[model samples]
Target: MPRLFLLAAVLAATTAIAAPDNPPVPLPKPPQADRTPAAGPPVPAEKPKEKQAPAAPEPEKEKETAAPAEPPPPPPPPVETEDRAAFEACTAELKSLGAAFRTLPRIDDGNGCGIDKPVAMTRLSAEVAIEPEVTARCETLLQLAHMTRDLIEPAARLGLPDMGRLKAVHQASGYVCRKRNGAETGKISEHARGNAVDISALEFEKGPVPMKIAASEAPDLAAAFQRTLNAAACLYFTTVLSPGSDDAHRDHMHLDVMKRTGGYRYCR
Candidate 1:
């Protein structure tokens, strides 16, 4: 009986230990719409390329569309003046006069006076007071004065009364025997060739007034005279000096064709 009880106890203990050792496993389930598979790491998808078309050629645009190229800038117009024809004619005549005197050999008056002796030409005539010592082309000198008158007359007609009434012109001194100055002698002055004229101002009804005297006493008349004479000189003379200059010249208006295209003008 003791042996039977021991065997039964041993079997009971083994069964109890085995029962707690492992639980029963459940059966596999069928796939369902809502069920998901076991997941792994995610991977990236590749991008697709687009098809390309051929490039087209471009045509040139017309010049009209390109800012018109600025029209190449029109040339400047020529200068116009009222006395263009007469002025040009006088200039040509004056040129001829110059050619005649350019070749005359310079002759020195042998009196230790360093002055050139001028040759007198019989061609020009004069009406102004002439210094006996100086000689000049008479015809050319007269022509210059006449041309000056023509220029002044037209301007005078414009009702600039102060320029004087285009009165008779009187050339006081032209060709003179003196040197350019009383001191050291040099080339003969324009007076030597009668290429220059000293106008004793203008002849107003008040008599021939000197430039210096008029500037202080009659400013309007003086200004008009100076302006008109200067304008006339531009057409006739290359050089024009007036009493308005310094003490070197305070007596008369001196006019000469020494320059070519430009000369000094005065208004006093």
Candidate 2:
């Protein structure tokens, strides 16, 4: 019995000795939220693009326009019409009187001294010739003719018996373009308007008798005839300027039909 128990103990001890020596190691645990790593440098934000302004529009062209029209002119004066009629009538009368005359055009000096219609008288009547020809207005020529027929011839028969028949009238000046008394400036002379005559002499059938305004030193009959004619001229002429009037009229007799304001006669 003892031996058998001893054998059982020895078998249990051998079985223990036959087992492995090394043991297995255990795995690590997972990371928690509080134990995470820190964040890196932050990335820079991107910059926005700049906006641009719009351009201005071009100006429009101006429109074309038309201009206005001008007005008409005025008519002529009434006095001019009347003067024209009077001049025409005078020309007709001259034709009827058998006076040898020619119609001349208007004479204007552009200084307010002018004749509208003038006549160059060649003869006073059929028998009486105007020596050197007298250029004057129709009215002035008519007056000259009337004086020759009515007064001069009849008076010559009495005062100038030696040369009783009339032949021609010697005119020194007619239709002269000058101011009064040949002055440079003043009222226009009647001669400028063909309204005056400067009688220098009278040609008779026998001979020519030169007119001397201051005839105190001349022959008795000649002086008497000149004086008589000088006095008679005032009856027909509106103005009669003889030698004694002024130095300007020393040689010849100045006769005109210038109108006066009060039917006054200017005989000097």
Candidate 3:
């Protein structure tokens, strides 16, 4: 009877401790995934500032600046009426002399004469009357002629020695009114437009340079003529070649406006 009582107590204890067969409550449904993104503790709005030492001052910012403006370009110079009139008159005169010359606009040498500063006669209309191919060059030659005459005639006014002393001043070899080299080739020479003149020898009252015995031996007369020609050449022509230059130049003095370029002068 005591053993029976012990077994009944044991059975009661086991029944009281045994788990139920029903499933768990399901955790109260969580809060639905659509209603809440996560299951975490709520975050504070503003973080609490911690007490600390004082901070150093920051440097000031520099102000931005604007760039400077560029200067304006200058204006063109006024044309000279006097120069235009003079050129017109000269052109008319040349037309009467059988020259087929024409007047054209002058191109600036790009020296900034108008842009940098103003000046009278800023441009020139060169006289060109050569063949069609070299017409422009021929007009330049005509202008060279005028320039040459301007130089030589002044010397005569200054009481310089007359060329009459030379053997063939006007008659030794007449002006060909032709090109540079021989007369056969159509290729134009510097002389075609009166830019150059040839003098095989000079004539004087005494006789031609060849006929005069002492004159041929003396260098003064020849030297004087050469000096005069060269001086005039410097004023009018960009290039000047004489008998002394080379064998090709042994016959005549060749002069041309081969230089006055880009406002640079080359006279020799």
lDDT values for all models:
0.50, 0.80, 0.43
**Which numbered prediction scores highest in TM-score against the true structure?**
2
**Which lDDT tens digits does candidate 3 get at residues 56-76?**
677776777777776654433
Write one digit per residue (lDDT tens) for candidate 1, span 1-268.
9999999999999988889556889888887879898777876766666666766767766556545454553432221112445534644564454422221234433322111323333222232222222344433454554554466456554535544444444556765545453334455555544457666644444355444433534446445655656556655656667565656567767776543445553333
Estimate the TM-score for candidate 2: 0.65
Better of 2 and 3 by lDDT: 2
Mark the 10 consecutive residues where model 3 has the least summed lDDT. 113-122
1 or 3, which is superior by TM-score? 1
Q: Which lDDT tens digits does candidate 2 get at residues 65-112?
A: 666655543321111112777878887777676779998777766555
TM-score of each: 0.41, 0.65, 0.33
